[model samples]
Target: MIRFQLEESDREVGRFWIGFLHAFRTIFPGFGQRFLAGIVDHHQQPAPTTIAQLTNELEQKNWELILENSSLISSENWWSGFVEWLQPFKEKHSIVFLEDSGKMMRKAGEELIHGISPKLRIALTASEIWWPRWFSEEFPGENCTELWHKLRVANNIKDFSSEIILPKRNLLTSLQNQLRREDQELLIQQIRSMINWLQDQGEWLEAVRLMQNNKDFEQAGEILQDKVEDWSSSGADPLEVLFWLKELPGVLLTSKPVLCLSAAQAANKLGFNFQVSYFISAAENNLYALQHFSRNDKLWREMVLDESGTTVQGILAQITQIRIGENHETEF
Candidate 1:
């Protein structure tokens, strides 16, 4: 008997096996209906005599018997009877035994395992079947990568799209408490990897959002700085930059004069007169905060004497000359 059982929750999977077997039987009717009869008769009667008669009727037909959900049989006597009947035919014919629970198999006794050769025993999990179908050759098993892949596939996220952001965030929130500790750690690693990949692809705003989700504000700030710098040079959509900047924590935004300056630039570009005035004031306030720090402080020294020799004071003076209605151009 080639005995194996699929993981729990696979109620319809038996039908697939049954259909395949029925097709095979249809292809070769000369093999007779004994195998199918034995399966049906075993289920209907489940008596020792029924098994014996089925065994005797085989007469070296070279057939295999498949028992689906055999563990579901509640009678210990039936199990014993089945085992006894199989002793003589063990080497002559193949019997496939299916069970849902290994605990039930052990509770029944060692006889089930001993009666069936250890080499023929197989256990299958739901993930083994389900994950492979959707992911094909790229399935990475049950890990953070698998979860991320599933999320990406489920949301059809080919690239960074605003439509999928909320759905993906909600899905992650739902899974936070449901996943195992190791899986959660794996998910964290996957998120970090995704953030790095987004940054590499120059999807800076998307990378910052992911870092924010991970609560890696420091990294998010660094990436946001890069994004602002890139936008300033590339003349990218400034409103988009302003929107993401507003999403950042106020403390983080106010701590960096460059961030505040970028917001001011974006507002000015978009012709938001009030916002331009507000962000410019915020930039000057942050610049004032920077000026008060000890000159020896690393942040103070970096802002005052950057590699390009561009100072926050210099940028502040340049921005202050702009009127609300004029097309003001400020450089960092």
Candidate 2:
């Protein structure tokens, strides 16, 4: 019944085993008290070499202890040192242990794959194989793609959920600084596929941001356009609209006017007069810039109209009507 906490920092150092040993001592008093005393050397600590010798002795003793009392450790503590007992209980207990620890320990299941036989390895769920924290600090930068390819082939994996895809997305993300031009381009395609999957779930903005991070500016712009249109059509929050508008890479001159139009429409719907004016002014200023690069007026017009259910042309017409009315009043 001993409670153990896994600190985020504990995962980085080898002292995680020490924490487990301390907790194990609490549950089984007789064994734990003797084990801790031998390891700690009666609080009269020795020199560095002696401490190292003591640690080795502690590990050996722990093995003997785990061998005799496997039930003392819970599945949650499996990665703590209970894995050492797997040799005896592996056949009947392996899968359940793998499933439980795989989800809980974050990275232990992937490491456990190295210790077990191929048959046991194959029994692991896709989730365990592609465990979210599969990428570790010591991972070689360039070989990540090859490593994923090997895992896919070894596991006969044909499809990927977000669990698998997101890790690959992160691997591709990290490789951005280290990969060659050709390799980056190759990863861009994989990144694009995952982004597309995310978009289907209404995660357009996050996907757009990731694409922008990868410097896939063109694709990011395309997705941003779709996002602006989708948000405007759905009557999304004006503040949320502004948040995304600011995230757009300003160098995408062609998308700027279209996004501004959508934002203006969203702001107007929410009765935010200041935001509507800001976006309308932006769209008007960018129209001339859009004209220089874009030849398709029809597509530009549709971007302002179809997506928001009201056209830039319509807004201009309303202004004209007001101006004409004021002119007539002045004449009268």
Candidate 3:
């Protein structure tokens, strides 16, 4: 005989909500008929002779099927029925225990639960590869994600023990392109544009610094690679830091780096983690803002089309104004 209880906080084995559900489901078929007999056999003190008589006495419940599933339950999936805001029995959980019941358990996991209850059932699993490690500490008994990952690999190998397989996405590449193309006018435009872009991207650069200083490689990679816009399409490279790469505000020109340019020039120094979002319209306008104003919507007009008439300072002011106006508008 085994006692049954449902608890939410307790991570104890054979006492979880899932364990109770499984146990109930397992014993329900035989217990249902016994329950019916127990109800029917309600009478004045009947003969309490055999073990079977005690069984019938214990099984009776005259009321309708009040409690349905109760067998071989697990701790997982107990949260399925839990609703916090509206109180059920207690504020924490609706726990009821069964005393002195025979118990049988299913497998350690619900690997085949899908075949049983497919659509209605949601799987209880922690992420293996990408899950945060704190989850394991939160629920120590819930199978180890690390071990589970290894188990999956081991199972895969056992299924095809002799087979040696290569990855589907197997490719090899080498050789780097060695062309140095520099348009002085475009460079000036890029340098100016980046200096202004830095103003809007100060916090982002700070986040980058934090990552670099702390050696947080992943976050650094993300901040440097995330796209600024979704719709624009252009061939681009990572580590293209087009924003806010300016010298200090009050610094002398001689005290600053040798030169400042039109575009982000920090990519070569930084890893391929940062990227510059280039809008063709913005670039075109920056190149031709003062003299020609180019087309209103062309995204990629050569910025320094007429370098003499289109100075970097003017282009920076126009682009900055356009950007400010854009930011002012609610894009939502």
- Give each model's whole-structure lDDT: 0.48, 0.44, 0.29
> How well is each residue in 143-202 modelled by candidate 1, as lDDT tens digits?
433433543555522233422322222222222324554455555654655556556656
Clashing pairs in 2: none
Clashes of 2: 0
Q: Which stretches of candidate 2 lie over 4 Å from their true place?
A: 1-183, 198-206, 251-255, 267-275, 288-312, 315-332
**lDDT per residue (tens digit) for residues 1-332 in model 2:** 34454432233222334455555556544333222222211112223453344444444443322222222233343345435533453443321221122232223324323443332222122111232223322132334445445545544233456454322221222222234444544454545555665576566676776565455667776666656666666766664565445444444522465666665665555444555556566667765454555567765544453354655555455444534654575598
* Model 1 TM-score, all chains together: 0.44
Q: What TM-score does each of the candidates earn? A: 0.44, 0.37, 0.18
TM-score, cand. 2 vs. native:
0.37
What tens digits encode model 3's per-residue C-alpha lDDT throughout 1-332?
22333322123221232233334445453333222222111111112332244334334422111222232233345333332311333333243434212212112123322232211111111110112233243335555344334434533111122221211100000000111133334433432333234335453554453343333444443344342211012433222232222111112111211112232223222211111122323344434443355453343233342323444444456546545544565374
As for candidate 1, its clashing pairs are: 1-95
Task: Flag the better candidate by lDDT, 1 or 3.
Answer: 1
- Winning model by TM-score: 1
Of the two candidates 1 and 2, the one with more favorable lDDT, higher being better, is: 1
